[model samples]
Target: MKSYLGLIPISAKVHRRQNRMTILCIVFAVFLVTAVFSMAELGVRIEADRLLEKHGSQELENLAGSTMAQTLYPIAAVLTLLILIAGVLMISGSINSTVAQRTKFFGMMRCIGMSRQQIIRFVRLEALNWCKTAVPAGVALGIMAAWLLCAVLRFLVGGQFSEIPVFGISITGIVIGSVTGIAAVLLAARAPAKRAARVSPVEAVSGNEKGTGALRHGAKLCLFRVETALGIHHAVSAKKNLILMTGSFALSIMMFLSFSVLVDFVGYLMPQYSDASDIDISGSGGADTVDSGLLDTLSGMEGVKRVYGRRTSFQVPVEISGAAEGFGAAESSGAADLISYDDFGLDCLKKDDMLKKGSDISKVYGDSGYVLATSDADSLLRIGDKVKIGAEELEIAGLLKYDPFSSDGLTHGEVTLIMSGETFIRLTGITGYSLISVQTTGNVTEEDVEAIRAAAGEDCVFSDRRDQNTSGTYRAFAACVYGFLFVITLVTVLNIVNGISMSVSARTKQYGTMRAVGMDGRQITKMIAAEAFTYALSGCAAGCAAGLFISKWLFDVLIAAHFAYAVWELPVNSLLVILLAVILAAVLAVWAPAGRIRKLSVTETIGEL
Candidate 1:
């Protein structure tokens, strides 16, 4: 060899089996960054097209630079950072275990006059060498995943995503993934490399260089069996390894909990109502000219599931009773938007659980002199307050959790009073509806829409929004969040399994000695299981404690701050699911290692490593 540096590739080649976990970590990190950024690019493209089509070029330009439009990049960046951290933890643990096993090899190099800097370079270069194959494989897998996601959005979703290219390549994604993979591998190799250089030649050559702290006391045998207690001791004996393993498991849970908040944020951002219409019919010039009888006509149609209409009068004068006067009533000249809902509309509201606590939907369902109001943070309106319109005084029997009309859940300076259609007609002396909405059956066709259009005549405006429902945004968001969660879970499980297997391999000689001392295979297996469980239990406790606070913080920032109606609650179901996953991972992690230990030839294992 020309120089000691030439041994780097040879070392990696000889230790290929042990290096697989490190390579996998790099691949996973690269894949995540590539897939996420690629999907973000596609999503931005799809959203831009939809906006450009809905509004003209001038309006599109205005919205293109808006804060909402620029949110995707920051979100993608955060996800990339999380994936990077996970990669570092997994890869570092793997390399540390490898170094502990190869103490003699590094010690020999040091004895042959290898400088510490050269040893560090050799270890780092060995790690980088694996990236030659890992990076390309990861990028390829990432591109395929992005293509698959695009296909799902375009074919299955089929709304605003119809124009997205299924097989498109994103240069930005490719570059970012490659760079992140290299960076993660380099960062992960640093501490292990330095530790390897610090290995003492005399201890390593004498075969006493097993990297573990001397125990200050014996295992607590009273609480557990001999085998289990020994296994727990083995786990806790290596303080660094214990920390790495626990951190890997805990980070996975934390990331899962944090990402879950995004699902709720998306729900609020594109709030979908249970009564959302597939088709809408409204009067021209914002007038209540559409016949209210058309609601019944559409409801009876063959392809219609249900129908509802609203009679609305904007900025109607009103008189507020005591305690209701703080709703900016005096400044706005006692004006509020007056709206009336039919039985079906009120039923939809009840089904959607939009009514706040203590709401009484029954009184507002009929011609009773009780009405519902939409509230915001600053409003002083409450249930049981009186709102007088003209000569009639209507009691506020309920309040909506938010102003459904406003995107941010705020009323934006105007109070809204909602009542039954009969009460509205009695108060305003108007019988026509300003807007009518139709819910369609599963097999609804254009013929049904045309029939309804013919019934309403050309005087009323018609809109078909079946393919443009906002629920698609929710589905897309859910798919993305769950996809990320699945990847994180896979990485966590693999890290746990790999770490346990390495632990088993490093302690093979010890196991063989125990076997020679008459410890049976079952005892050995129990010992391994105990070790795995120790790691799992510690990780679970730490993960859940940190995850709960992070989940709440994310919820407060992403959902609660902007939307007055949103509140954080304990995610019991999420906690249960995460705990179940961690338990399953621990079981799986123990399986292969225990089996290998059970099948080991005691004499050969003792003589080999």
Candidate 2:
């Protein structure tokens, strides 16, 4: 051979089976990063098309300047960073395990006049060789995944996304994937390469290398049988290995929990309120001129699922009977918007969780004197407080969590008083509605929308929004989020399984010796399981603790800061699901390694290098 580097390919060829897991890790990491960026770019394109088609160039320019558009690329960048961190942890653990197994090989190189730097260079280059095949494969898979998602959005979800180009390829995705794959492998190889170079020739040649070293302490027998205790001992004895394994598992959990916040933010950004209508009929200049009888007429029409009407009186003078602490000092007179709701509208509020704590809907359901006020009406108005509008006194029976009419969850300097239609007519002596809304069934056709529009006549302003109900944006966003989450989950499972298998292989001789001394397959299986559980338990604890903080921070930034109505709470459901997943992963990780251990011949295992 011209140089020691010549052995790199030969060694990889000989150990290809052992290196396959490492290669898979690199491929998956590249795939995730590429697919995320690709999908994000496609989402932007699709949204732009929808805007240009529906609202023209001026509206599209306005959207481009909007906060949502400005934040889109930054969000994608953060997601890419998360994917990179996870990939590094998983790939580093795999490389470290491989180095530990090959201590003798590295030591032999050291003994043959190879310098420490040469050994390091050899290990790094060997890792890079795997990327030649892995990177291309990963990029291909990522492109195909992006195309598949585009096809789903374009053909399967055909409302706003019908014009999305399924065959469009993202050059940015390709370049990023190729670069990230190579960079990740190089970064992951650094520590492992350094450790490999540090192996002493004497210990390695004498077959007393670190991987086969005797335990510093005997397995404790207090908690379980000898086999299980030994397994646990194996996990904790190697501090570096334990840390790497635990970190790998922890990163997956953290990513899952952190990304879940994005789902909530998306909901806030594109809120589909419970009372949103497929068709709306409003009087000229928002006057209360639409007859209340129109509600029943629309409700009786074919394909109409439900109909509700609202009566609004803007900037009505109000008098507070109590301390009036809820009103600002400047607005002591309490200028408010008086609105009325029917039974269906009241029910919709309850269904949407719009009522604040301690709200009582029964008090305001009919002609009862109690009324509901928006939470922003006054900071100090509690249920049971009294307010006077005109000559009548009304009790505040409940408060809404937000102003459902306002998109930003703010009331914009006006208190909103909502009561039953009977109460509103009694107080204002007006039976007409300011606006009427209709919700149609899933099979609603254009003819149904036309008939409703024609019945409303030319006096009222009509709007048909059935196309908006198709939920194109919501589905596309959900598919992307869940798809990325699924990729993280798959990578995590593979990492756990690969790490355990490498650990088992490294201790083959030790396991064989135990089997020779009457340790059965079931005992071996228990021992392996105990070790896997140790990693899982530690990882879950650390991950959940860190994840909770990140989740809350993201919630504060993305949801709470923008929406006055959002509140943070414990993510109990996410915790339980992740815990269950970790436990199941631990169980599955032990299956193949234990089977391989059981099938090993004692003599061959003890005799083989």
Model 2 scores a C-alpha lDDT of 0.82
The local distance difference test score of each candidate is 0.83, 0.82
- Per-residue error for 606 in candidate 2, Å, reads 6.4
Range of the 10 consecutive residues with the lowest summed lDDT in candidate 2: 323-332
How displaced is residue 411 in candidate 2, in Å? Answer: 2.1
Candidate 1 residues lying further than 4 Å off, grouped into runs, are 1-16, 42-70, 107-118, 149-168, 200-208, 221-231, 282-293, 310-373, 381-399, 412-434, 441-443, 458-461, 511-527, 541-573, 601-609
**Model 1 agreement with the true structure over 460-540: per-residue lDDT tens digits:** 899988877867667766787788778777777787889888878778778878887789988998999999989989988
TM-score of model 1 (CA atoms): 0.80
TM-score, every prediction = 0.80, 0.83
Q: How many residue pairs collide in each prediction?
A: 0, 1
